[model samples]
Target: MSAGVELDHVTVRFGEFTAVDNATLDIKGGEFFSFLGPSGCGKTTILRTVSGFLDPSEGMVKIGGQNMTGIGPNKRPTALIFQNLALFPLMTVAENITYGLRVRGVDKTARTKKANELLDLIALPGQGDKLMSELSGGQKQRVAIARALAVQPKVLLLDEPLSALDLKLRQHMRSELRSIQRMVGITFIYITHDQGEALTMSDRIAVMSDGVIQQVADGKAVYDDPATSFVASFVGENNPFVGIITRADSSYAVVDTLFGTLRGRNPKGLKVGDKAILFVRPESAKLGTGAADTTFSSKVKSVAFEGNMTHVFLEGVGKKDVTITVGRHSSADIPAQDEIASVTYDVDLGLVLPEGKMARE
Candidate 1:
């Protein structure tokens, strides 16, 4: 019973401040879509608009090809799960799961049957009779999900529902949520500021900033081929080398940096003489490789020993903190503090973008 959702030229404003700028997006039914961004970046605003808690100042909100103009949340075929689970303290697990059915005047027998079915769906079968306080954090989360799903909403909107759990539990819930979505075949519209959560669960991600969507793509495309400088810096750890482009073409660009000329993919189509930033991921950087398109001698400032991979911080290059990641099992020697090291990276792995406002800046 999943339904498609669409925002056509949507804009939400609170008084003079525009919370969500003009944004048009189409979300396919049964797809796990996520809206990811920093706080106050209009992601939650869009979610609220879709949930019918707030109407857009301009444009249209549609679900299943029907315009949702002047529609209240209760009338819409959607269920929203907030960050706080908001379960009734005195209610039993079955009572919480069947609250919506009870509100609609379903008989106790039918409600209990529906509750047990949902408990089984959430992998918490046979635990319905227990009080809500008896369940653990992860278990309570599942009960909340079952409560929402019990209403059979075509579109389920979640706003950072897993942010309350511990790191391990949060990770566990990510898989659990995805599995539940696949099993129920409902369209899940998730809103989150956590990059890992979005990347781990979403079929497609819309990265928002300043009330605008910077990019909408799968996890790999968003991380590897960012369309903007903000996306390049926000999605992952990147070493940025700011300089003027010396050469440019459809596929590649060379930038004159502090270390020397560095070559990378010309994704933003910057021309020669344009100010640009070349982004190199730590994993794409190698140590002591002369075959790379860019090579610079750097002094090791520090090294973080992570299992399986070591992050080597380099100074005297790129005019900022440059990091290089190397496999711990590599035959190359790990550099120590103050040790002079040679850093190299393939040109294609570097994303060259026109100089613009960065996410951190």
Candidate 2:
């Protein structure tokens, strides 16, 4: 059983420094929500605030409609699984799993029974008596999860628990974590700097930078369409073309880049003279279409092939350095070049953003 969480205007301050600046979000019951950002972006600070290990400088942390203010981590209906996990190495897996129950005065038999049931749930049914040191890394991760679940917490907090694993194992663990969340039906709030982990495991992701959330949306939306220049550049690969808004309409704008006038989605409420940026993902850039809205030429600066895909870097056409990603099947076997070549995209494929709108992460 897991509980939903709500952070209303939650702000964390360490003396004069604000770690989390008025962050607000509602995480529904049984949903897997992720806080994703680079280090020192206040993601961990917010997670600590939610677990009651640290109180907010101001604002409220609510679980299941109950205020969590002044509540210690031990007293809250939430269980936090730190990156280290802190499993007792001297104890058997069963003993480690049931340590929380035993400390809470659960009878030995009952604790053992609960431990076995969780081991089974975690797919280690018959390994209860094995020492904690005997399990593999992934298995140890499962045991840690089982231990957290033993308390039947309404909310489970994980602080980058998958960071220590290798790439393949990390990918495997993302699926494991999501499946476990579904089985327990508890709200899971995960903190991670790895975009792949967050994108793979989360129901919704909050993109944070500079102690503020830039966008909170479903994974595809956050990747396919970003709300800000920061999100466009950070969430995934994008070619940011800086320019001034010259011609503006309700649906698109003509940006005056060094390469000349380029039409992009009209950002309404933007004045014609205001400086703005245009974002075009690599996938959106393609071979010339010979049409008015589908042409932009660039001097092919460089190209690199990584077997599955090709990276094309462009420059010299008055436009700044822009990269184009082409899949192996779709990419032509063109040699790397310093010569000029035209690249194109439909006008609708690019997004116009206000200049200097994103604070650094």
Candidate 3:
């Protein structure tokens, strides 16, 4: 029984400081929605506001079309899974999973039955008797999720629950969590700064910056069609060429950059003479000149071969070095150090946006 969540003109202020500034969002029922941003971007504040931990200073909060003005966290139909996962070490796995039921005075037999069912649901069948310390990191994570689901919450809020796990385990849990959410059919509101986690698991993502919602779209849209310069620079690797637009049209813009005059897709509709940045992704950049719209010559500074891709660092693209990613099976010949190379990219793959705040690495 999943429920939709709505925040209408929500604003949360801490005296002179505003944590969330007039953010309006609609999270559909049974959707895996994620709020992604760096720390201090008000993602946690929005989560707390939805969970009834902190009431918005202004505007309305609704759950399943019901206004939650006076409702407390305990009364709300949402369950919050914190980062630390406060499971009691003294209690057995079954006891931890049914602690919420025990607090409501459920019969011992019923609680035990519910615990076994949840253990099975979490894929830890017949492990109810194990202690908390006996379980692995990933197993403990599953138990925490089972405990949260025991109360049958309509909406489940997770605050970076996988941040503590290692890289491989975190990647594994992303799929596991998505599977669990689908099995139970509950609305999942996940908060995370990790782009991989959000992009991998979420049906839709809301990217926030400085207490403001920058863009709300699917993972592909956020990566390929960023609305702001911060988003284009933040979400992935990009080579930004800052210059003034010399020519503009409905679909394309030509910018006079340090390297040379470059053309790219003009989504922002920048007028001629306006300062802009042409962003080209490393993977989209090719070492040799083909039929690409833009081409530049640079000296290869270095080349590093990763397992699957080779990164060729080049100079002469201005103060900042340019990176060209070549796949292992790429047909282009790898250049040695100090060798001049031709870099090319199609205009359709490059983004020309108005100059704005760039994300720090």
Candidate 4:
């Protein structure tokens, strides 16, 4: 049966360096949860703690409401699919999938039967007799997942298992993974730095930075309503206008920036004179719209056509370049380089945030 996982004020230390710092959260049973962050930001540390490979220096780890403080990974009702996969090259696909059952001394006939069932479960039916060397990268990934599932783990922990596949295959495997998780009806704890992977697969995401979780929410919430400047800039492409708040009310904040006054939603409740940044997504800015909530002029520096849309980079009222995305189907006029253009956007789509640490690319 599937089980919920929880971390209560978890902290992990390596010598004097704190890897994970007081992280507290819950992963619902049968839910797909992801921990997303840049490298060295302690995302993997939490996964390790939950997997029982490492114990937290402080606090508790629980699965199915049972404390996991003294448990070893082998004894826990969980399976970890490592980034390297760790499949035996000499073993056939079925042999690899049944390796765990073999280690537990399950009969060969039973192991083989279970392996065949898993082969069908992973959409690799009739390919179990093939050697590991004969499988493609994506095939190997599925085999690894099948092996993990062979144990019928209550919680499955994956650490960037898709990192080795090409772009198209990785995208395909994301769907496959999600489908497999649903079929098994188990809690999935995925660790990844790839935003696309997390956003596409997770029921909820925990965005982390510098050993701290910046925000935890559904993908749309994290993207459309970021709780921090770091989240706003990191989740997607954004044009930032750094300035001091000129006026603020319960619903809106107006900032006096190099590009003149700009108003946006005031979810952060910034006061006048407070340093803030207004983050407007490229698609949020429209070309030559007089009916918009805010209007600004920019000198077009470059244009890159991307089939469905064109990205226009401009030199506006600041040192940094501003980018606006124009959909091909829109009635807005596309401009040539060196031409002046007016851009406008609604205030509600713009996100104003108090200046804080942003993610480094």
Between candidates 3 and 4, the one scoring higher on TM-score is 4
Between which residue pairs do clashes occur in model 1? Answer: none
Clashing pairs in 3: none
lDDT of 4 by residue, 95-175 (tens): 999988988999999998999899988878999899999998888999999999998899999999999889999999999
> Which stretches of model 1 miss by more than 4 angstroms?
291-293, 316-320
- Write one digit per residue (lDDT tens) for candidate 3, span 1-361: 9999999999999999999999999999999999999999999999999999999999989999999998999999998888888888999999999988998899999998999999998889999999999999889999999999999999999999999899999999999999999999999999999999999999999999989888999999999998888888888889998999999999999999887888999988899999999999999998877543498778889999998999999994546689899999999999999999999998799899999888876
Backbone clash count, each prediction separately: 0, 6, 0, 0
Runs of candidate 3 with Cα error greater than 4 angstroms are 290-293, 316-319
Per-residue CA lDDT of model 2 for 142-208, tens digit only, reads 9999999998899999999998888888888899899989988999999998888889899999998
RMSD vs true structure, all candidates: 1.8, 2.3, 1.7, 1.6
Write down the RMSD of candidate 2 (Cα, Å).
2.3
**Candidate closer to the true structure by lDDT (higher is better), 1 or 3:** 3
Q: Write the per-residue lDDT of candidate 1 for residues 1-361, one digit (tens) a residue.
A: 9999999999999999999999999999999999988899999999999999999999999999999999999889999898898988898999999998998899999998999899889889899989988999999999999999999999999999999999999999999999999999999999998999999999999999989998999988899998888888888888888899999999999989887788999977789999999998999988886654588777899999899898899894545678888897777789889999998888789889988767763
Q: So what's the TM-score on candidate 3?
A: 0.95
**Residue 252 CA error for candidate 2 (Å)?**
1.4
Q: Which numbered prediction scores highest in lDDT against the true structure?
A: 3
Per lDDT, what order, best first? 3, 4, 1, 2
Clashing pairs in 2: 2-154, 3-154, 251-266, 252-265, 252-266, 259-318
